[model samples]
Target: MPFERVRLERVRLEPWKRRPELAALALLLGLLMMLHSHIPNIAGVGSLVESLLPWFGVYVPVLLAGALWRRSPSAVVALVLPVTVWLSLFGGLLTDKSHPGGDLTVVSHNVGAGNSDPSGTARQLALSGADLVALEELTDQARGTYEKGLAKAYPYHEVRGTVGLWSRLPLSDTRPVDVVQGDVGPLARTKPPESAAEAAAEVRALRTTVATEHGPLAVYVAHLGSVRVMPSQGFWTDSRDFGARALTKAVAAEPNQRMLLLGDLNGTTDDRAFHGLTSRLTSAQETAGNGFGFTWPAAFPIARIDQILVRGVRARSSWVLPETGSDHLPVGARVSW
Candidate 1:
């Protein structure tokens, strides 16, 4: 009886303590994924990894489920490593936080170049009661529609090439910024030009001073050149990177302390290429929003290319409005000094 009891105690087994190697491998992969930004951009692969960096967090859930199914104590324990790392990186963004009130209300939208109803989009934005509105991808034919629609609400506005800014307050010293320096228009601009005029034609960025009740706020409205992933060329970001660098320089050279940058940057802040802009500006959504606040492809939004970033001010709240006629939804933010 004593020998049988001792053998039973020594041979006791559980399903949960079966596999440890699987869990360790999963955590190790997760750790590498967490440090994706530190990875090199060999043949532009690093930048590509950075672009999809945030999505890597999804792997944690998969690993979690596997760990539970295998019921391995070591594997479950290893999962803590990736879980902690993911939370440390993106934990702040997952929470819904906000301040009480704000002084200024601003909105930004891409409004889709092929949008069938530009006037309707403008009307929808005007109804939002925003003090300032910024629109990108403004086509030549649809520009008039937006201007006429928003004229009564936003009397002071400026348009340069495909981007425009409309404000209820007075706007002054408006100038086109050459985010993409070339003669070819943005629609035709895929690569750098050989003998194009400096900061001429196809301007995708504009800067102006807005006289608000709080003070003068320097506003920059931009539609940075779009990027793509081609089968032959790989991850295409040459134009967007060029534009981001130029815009960063322009913003740094700015004399004003308070600034607001509204645009469809065509890339997320997670991407390393946007360091120039993200370093200088703070995202309103990350500061005060309920969820991910994705604003592209209104039908089934994925990423937040359209953004409202502020500096020298505090954002009390930020939210993405309901879907409009355009492909992208409108994004709004409330800010105060």
Candidate 2:
């Protein structure tokens, strides 16, 4: 009966019924990644999924390993679905797209308010060799330090609210764009700052135009409302999402065609919340960086919340700068007119 036993083992290994559960899971993962936007945002599930979507490809290999262990031919073949979907979505990010030089080099950083050494951070930024540097979360105590520290490198600078732009070039039409979506959501109960300066210090977005040899390049520096996970509320993103929508309106009214948006947007281009902004601007990191340029929780970054997006400008190269004292790393990009 050795021949019969061999036939049974072969049949079990080759049949679609073997490891059917694994096959189904493979299909599910493929569809989930492909149609993540339609997953619905109840409890911020959709945002969470899309924010970490690129990492979902990790499951494909796990499933493949399981299939191999089980010796299920059907399961191994089914893994192809998720693999293809994953490569289609994130394969482009695997290669280096950065070019050698460009007309402008801009760097954006959140510069955590809780950063212990603002002066050190400023010094690092000044020596970073950027034509323009945009900073967010400028506390009252650190503002002067940054202005002084970045002065030698960047002769011209402008600060509107907590957002500021320090540039080697001239700046004009400087103003703050309010991104507060009323007093609702997670920040509804947040206490107001002590004085007018403090209140202004609390503001998180600004718009300014830079005088370039080619033309006027409008630059926006923003730090959208923060997000968090709550046991009771699931993935809490009300504040961040509201801020994104408000920022979208301001961008929609922008007059300049050549524009550069730099900041810790508090969300990635992968997240659907930035759809309006992404539709208008191209992410420098996504277009030119070698890999996923994650810039958050500086110690070990997993998501790319900081961004340098441009319109009517070619992003020749993109990269992440060395760690500063802040919680988020700096993102730099070279753009040409």
Candidate 3:
């Protein structure tokens, strides 16, 4: 009887010993992920991993609960660090409630370059009742279609590089923004354009001032270069990193007090790469959105790359519009002075 009791005690303590190590590992991973923003050029791999980090917060608590139930006090304590960090980063999301209050309506859409149905996409965007519409990935072929389709509703419009802004109000001072492209090393300069037309197509970043009823709102529409993952390289986001930095500098230099940036940032607001932009602006969705507001791959959006950010204006309500023909869904926000 004594031997059996001792064996049972050992079995019970075995799980406790393992729990500490597991808990420690989880804590370490969580910390690394949290600090991922500090590591440069992680766009390819880091960005992808970071996109999923918010989900880990869900499992960490459950694991800690299990540890506590098993009477592992040390393990429970180990969990505290990660739990605190995660909550600090994402806790605000818990209290977000949709409240309607603004006067101006704005929309942002990526309208994938490869979209097969530009007309359908244009029609859907026009119906959103937006006072201002900003579009990215505006390839030459689709520009005319968009201009013609949207002209009926938005009489004032401007296109710079591959991005465009259409407004119910007049738009002026439109120009291309010079976002840094990664070091193609000497190769890019020397590599002749595939054709003269391809060389002209190179122009693709733009900014414009929308003359809203309230005043002139500086609007920036940009598409950061895409990030790619590779086995040997780990991650490749240098182009996006450079572009984001340049854009940040430009926004900082702008003379206007009120600013609105709408586009497919190629990153989430949570991404550190966007710290420059996020630090200066406020996300409309977090203030008045009802849900996560994911707006990519229209089939099922797990992440939000399309966004509407504002400064000097209050967000009344924000939401994603129904899918058009593009891969991304449209995002709309109501704002006021």
Best by TM-score, which number? 2
Give candidate 1's TM-score. 0.88
For lDDT, candidate 1 versus 3, the one ahead is 1
What's the lDDT for candidate 1? Answer: 0.84
* CA RMSD (A), model 3: 3.9
lDDT per residue as tens, model 2, 1-337: 6999999998877743477988889889999988988999999999999999988988988998888887777888888888898899899999999988799999999999999999999999999999999999888889999999999999999887778999999999998887763746655737766798766866789899999999999999999988888888899888888889988898888989899999988888989999999999999988989999999889999899999999999999999999999999999999997
Off by over 4 Å in 1: 1-21, 182-201
Q: Rank the candidates by lDDT, best first.
A: 2, 1, 3
RMSD of each: 4.4, 3.0, 3.9
Tell me the tens digit of each residue's lDDT in model 3 across 192-234. Answer: 5688576546555677888777888898888777665656666
The true-versus-predicted C-alpha distance at residue 181 of model 2, in Å, is 4.5
- In candidate 2, which residue ranges exceed 4 Å CA deviation? 1-17, 189-195
TM per model? Answer: 0.88, 0.93, 0.84
Q: Number of the top candidate by lDDT?
A: 2
Instruction: Give one digit per residue, the lDDT tens place, for model 1 in 47-159.
Output: 77776666777877787787777776777777778777777777887888877789999999998988987878888999999999999988878999999999999999998
